[model samples]
Target: MADTILVLAWLVLAHLAADFILQSASIAAAKSGHGSRALAGLFAHGWIVAAVVVPVGFAFGERGWWFVLLTGLSHIAIDRAKVVLTRRAAAAALREAHDRHEAPRPPEHLGRAWTPQPAALFLADQGAHLAAASGGWAVLLAGVPLDPGWTAAIDGWLGSWDRVAVHGVASAAVVLIGLAIVNIRAASLFVGILVRPVEVTAGGEHRWGGRVAPAPDPDIRSSTSAAQAPVGRRWSIRLGPLDARVIAEPEPAIASPASPSTPPLGGSARVGSTIGVLERILIVVFVLTGTDVAIGFVVAAKTLARFRLLDDRDFAEYYLLGTLASVAIAIVSALIGRAALGALLA
Candidate 1:
């Protein structure tokens, strides 16, 4: 039983190492949908998972082969299914958006509005992977045989069970740290790209980018591009001549709240990205302490805090979905942590 748990735990660690640590941004983005690019990403990821399994499995003898094949093939199958499904869903969404308006253009000009739910799909993909790992563990427990003398070797190799655990814990901690540092940043960027608002031209071509944010360089009037900017607002560059004076918005008699139609409330994506980092950290805390239910409170608080936007069904769904995505990512990360911890203590 201990060997079963040990092998399974290490497999989870390997999965995280491969999926989150080794996979690159280009692969992640390309693999979100079914295409040649997506196939390439899936194959590359499957191979990486198998490669990680090869060295780790050496500790398990013949059973290692069964574990490797099961987990690696399952990884490929899950990812391939996800790519096909996600791409289909995204295309359907784009089609629905197109159908809404006879002529598609900017969201401001066209009556149609549609954006891919990359955030949700990405979260679902991760949750599926974790679930698959769990399934593989169950398979090992039910069928695969552990080496009868493995415990003797483990004890002899490490000097004692306590020492074995200590070494395991240290190794696991290194992997977990790599997970936290690499996965969070990479996941954030991947989801950011996936969910970025895309504009589809009437000609059936998809285009990236949206309202460009105010550049950090304050000297906006210096560039040839500054001619298109307006004078007063933060988003506006100094468009006037060299001697022209600048004026700010006059203080109103009564301060009004920012409207839904107004520009993004925060100045830049920095605030949103920071919030994501914090969300994942809290999730790690909750998972490690076995306080998963508190995650519900986090979600509830966000929903209530944005109660004003509840009337806008579209906006509400977007906010709720994004929150759920964050929760899902955290849950996966926490599960990986638990697996690593188990390897250490088992």
Candidate 2:
């Protein structure tokens, strides 16, 4: 049972590391595009998936190699399916909009509308890959004894350390690493989707400036009758395949002189993402160490740095939503890790 748990943990760790950490942004983008480049990127990512799992396979013996081969192929197949499905879904959405005589905006133009199809598809894709990993392990490796030679080598290397102790340590490490990966990378993707803003235009007015509070007001219709009228252009915020919310057009922003050109957003976005990653990591550490009270200091420091920006209602909402989500993910991951470590060591 211990061996099975350890091997499964390693399998999950490898999958997460390959899919999230090692896969380059360019490769991920290319995989979602057309032509031979897409195929090349897909294959490259598949190779990485296999490579990361090779150590586990090698340790497990000959059957492990076969497991590695099947996992790699399955990953490529799953990703290809996601790409095709996403394209078809996008096309169908555009067709539906055209049939209604509405001007169709591209998905990107939606500016991360709440629960967008792409984000749903991304979550589904990852879920499929993880399912494959767990299912493959159950089918191929469960109940099979660990390779004796591998165990003997590890024992020899550790000298006086008991094999069980080593396995416990290894399992703990794998669990912690997996939690860190999910808290940092996976949570970022999730929080971004959750905080996505849907743009609403009405009555042929295309005013597109100013940030609105993320939370929709229940009394918005009464408060802004002209803007909230049913007549005019509107878009649906999707929850998976369904339209979760249909926001009415909003009041126009007061026109002012065009502000000076700002720097490209790409750099700032990258910096913010990096900060978020660090913040989550620190939060996880605090939780695991039973220093939960220290988490307040971390949040305060982050908020203080962005205190001036928080004056903007839009920025404040975005910042608050993202911070809460990050903290939640970190806490949950840490708790899971703590439980797993306790089980392993006990």
- The candidate 1 region of ten consecutive residues with least summed lDDT is 212-221
Model 2: worst 10 consecutive residues (lDDT sum): 204-213
| Per-prediction TM-score to the true structure, in the order listed | 0.57, 0.67
Q: Give the alpha carbon lDDT tens digit for every residue of 1-346 in model 2.
A: 2266667677778988998899986787677666797799899999999999887676778878888999999999999987777655444443344345443222222331233564567679888998998898888887777788877787788999787777777887899889988987787766655554233333221111121112223233223323334454667687777776556775444221111232212355557777878888998888888898998998899999899988877677678877887788788888878777776677
**Candidate 1 to truth, TM:** 0.57
Can you write out model 1's per-residue Cα lDDT over 35-89, one digit (the tens) per residue?
5766787788888888887843554566666767777788888877765665555
The lDDT per prediction is: 0.56, 0.67
Clashes of 1: 0
Candidate 1 lDDT score relative to the true structure: 0.56
Clashes of 2: 0
Among the numbered candidates, top lDDT falls to 2
